[model samples]
Target: MKGMASYSSSHGRLAMAGNLALFCLILELASVGLAHADELRVGYYSSSCPSVEDVVRNTVTNAVARDPGMPAALIRLHFHDCFVRGCDASVLLDSTPGNPAEKDSPTNNPSLNGFDVIDEAKSTLESQCPQVVSCADIVAFAARESVRIAGGFYYPVPAGRRDGLVSKESEVNQNLPMAFFNVKQLEDNFARKGFSLEDMVTLSGAHTIGDSHCSAFSNRLYNFKNTTNASDPSMDQTYVSDLKSKCPAPGSGQDPTVSLDPVTPRTLDNQYYVNVKSHRGLLSSDQALMNRADTARMVLANINSGSMWLHKFADAMVRMGKIEVLTGTQGQIRKSCRIIN
Candidate 1:
């Protein structure tokens, strides 16, 4: 009888253990499901029922089609915001009227003035989609639209990001890649954000669609005269003459600039690679990719073949959008899309 009791006690303990393990498994699944539900909530507000991404893309494309000149400014704004804090839509705020140093101040970037675009897009999206979508998703979708309008292809954009309340002009100054960056500086900046050298080259294909303000690279065009130290032999004489006509001096407060793709200035095509191959790239940083042995092969491959460039560009954009994404309370829903608070 004692032996029977012992066996029964052991069986009861084992049954309890199995029940506990099953309960734990159910709890784990619930936690995961709750996390995913939170992500979806963070993506869209409860009041509205439309996809903000759709609204943003449509609005931006329409805006650009109405004013083709807006694509360059839009691209600049997108890059400035993304490079600063992972594209949180902080850069789209118009927080300060007079203080140009404020991160959310449109005055800081008089040339781009992204708030105007954001305002128009928001007003339209609100009218169409109502209160259903978040501004953070709008910004991401707008970035992709801006890039596409500038003559690039689309990549998968993972949605559900929230806007950040803070914008830092200083951060923009610190993070933006200069026209004079060597291959190493470019590689390091990209590497910090989990991108490889190949990704750097592929993403730089954005140069194919926009124009650089001569002010941004006067040092390369007018100041770099010494043949041994600062010469850029790749510049086209006609293009340089045109630039000089617009911007006569290095500090002349001029906007003289060259197109990344002189042939197809408005199309997002492989022309940027072709320009690099011919040594007509506008920025030293762009030309450097062609000069470096490490990245030169990739540059040549893209320039020599169209399909290869498109495939890599698409892949790199996907990789870029995935960098350090903010999901699960990493950020907040901005009542105002522009300001972090």
Candidate 2:
């Protein structure tokens, strides 16, 4: 009798432990499912808004054709939107009576554009499927199409992202990477958004297409830090001379603008990496990629290979599009992208 009782007690203990372990495993799996519950998937709109992508693609194609610079502008708009509030289309919101929005931020105000393209796409989408799609998704779709139009290949963008209601100007400064950031700072900024060093190097390749205002990098072309009159010593001398011709000294005139990738300013390609390797990077933050060995290796890899950077850039953009997305009824889909619904 005593032996039988002891065996029963031991079996009971083992059973409880097994049950506890199994419960923990279940909890872990559940948490993971909840975490990715809103995972964006390609063809998300196939059933609901089958013609949505077509509308957005045509809109972006027309816009980019009108102004070749529009592709970069659209990409920048998406980047700005994602970084601050996780690709929520908050950047598109205009200031309200009681609340200021992200679009009003100094960092975004002058730099970000291409709102018209998004609005046009949204109007078309609404005509086809009213309130079924989101402005956030529209922004993402436009961005992907813009990349395709700009010489970068088209990669599928997972949709289902909803628009965010809040858009604080103050949040932009803390979130967006600055043009003057060093390699470490750039890495940290991307890291906060769940990006790797390689991802950082890859997305920076977007600079391959587009022009930046002279004010963004005037310091790199003129008396850098008031310590030298010849501009940033790290820059290639010839490139510096060329930039000086385009930008001139600050007070001489209104802030001018220069192409980010002089070799192929209007083309989206791996040439940006080549420029980075040659120290022709327009932004100090761009040149800073070479300050670290790991990123420098990525820069070299991108420069050495053709089409490789484009593939990497597309992958990085997809990853970036997933940052802090609002889905599963988390946020409302705004009727007009500029105002919360």
Candidate 3:
């Protein structure tokens, strides 16, 4: 096969056949053909759902244009989905009478939006292709399109994931990382998900675009580590004051939100690393990346090289999309994304 990707910059260019193969092999992506039958492939829907890419692109483009935050929501929605049930769209499932779903978990609740986007895309695919495209694949592809719109980093999403049948609120916390995790905790969390220290740091750079409720980080502002009225010393004092103005102390009133990336909250870029380096990162987890030598090295690399980080981020996303995914006959293609069909 011909080279599948290339990148060029004032720094240099990499378009050779050997480079592409090495990168793909490293990423464990695009294992084409039935030989890797259950594995995902870049063009799995070439004949089955020929319009898959365009349909998702149109749907997400309109949504993001309407709401600038939609890109973050979609990107996070994909991450949350993959973390829990391996990109099976379990996060899209609605809560039944007795069983709550992952979406309602405190880690996710009220913040994880973009279900409508997935439903809308699935609705279109069902009408046109019908039962062929899985909700899991839709979530995965929608996430890739979302990244393209927000960061201009285009990555191929290998499809063929099947929707999962189970989504438990109980299972969420064990699988997902928390906001207050230190470097060791963060490394261990991603390691459990088959990600390296570099992968964890690269993926965390997605925080460049999102918003976080004050409730998520109030610990750092007031009563940090049982010290009343003391903010986290690692957090820049000016940024802390700015955050306090927006998010009143706990019990003050409604929980307002602040952008994850104060500099460019609408665009996915290396500004996240920039914030961490300045001690202005929003979440403790964001700020924590700079606490250690190895992770901090990764952060510095992202800070100095935006284009190269984009390439790494896309590669990480592709690897993430393959996590414990259900394909072939392992799971069903849900007729409606919200319910098991």
Candidate 2 residue lDDT tens string, 190-253? 9988788899989999998898888899888777888667588889999888888878687877
Clash numbers, per candidate:
5, 1, 0
Better of 2 and 3 by lDDT: 3
Q: Candidates' TM-scores?
A: 0.76, 0.88, 0.89
Model 1 agreement with the true structure over 1-341: per-residue lDDT tens digits: 99999999999999999999999998896676445334543234334545566667777878887877566666666666666676566666655654333343332455554566677667766676654345656665676777676655666565666566666565665666667888999999888666788888888887877666667655555647654334345777666665566655654555655566678887767788777777777788988887788798888888788767777776665455444445556667555565545
The TM-score of candidate 3 is: 0.89
Candidate 2 clash figure, as a count: 1
The whole-model C-alpha lDDT of candidate 1 against the native structure comes to 0.66
Please provide, for model 3 over 1-341, each residue's C-alpha lDDT reduced to its tens digit, 9 standing for 90 to 100. 12333224422444456677789885675443232334788899999889989999999999988899999999899999999968888999999999999998988888899999999999999999999999989988888998899998788888888889999999999999999899899899999877899999999999999899999999999999989899999999999999988998898878988899999999989999999999999999999998899999999999999999999999999888887788888779999999998
10 residues in a row with least lDDT, candidate 1: 99-108
lDDT-sorted candidate list, best first:
3, 2, 1
State in Å the error of residue 77, model 2.
1.0
- Candidate 2, after superposition: displacement of residue 76 in Å? 1.0
Q: What are the lDDT figures for the candidates, one per model?
A: 0.66, 0.87, 0.89
**What does each candidate score in C-alpha RMSD?**
10.8, 7.1, 12.5
Give the Å shift of residue 86 in candidate 2. 0.4
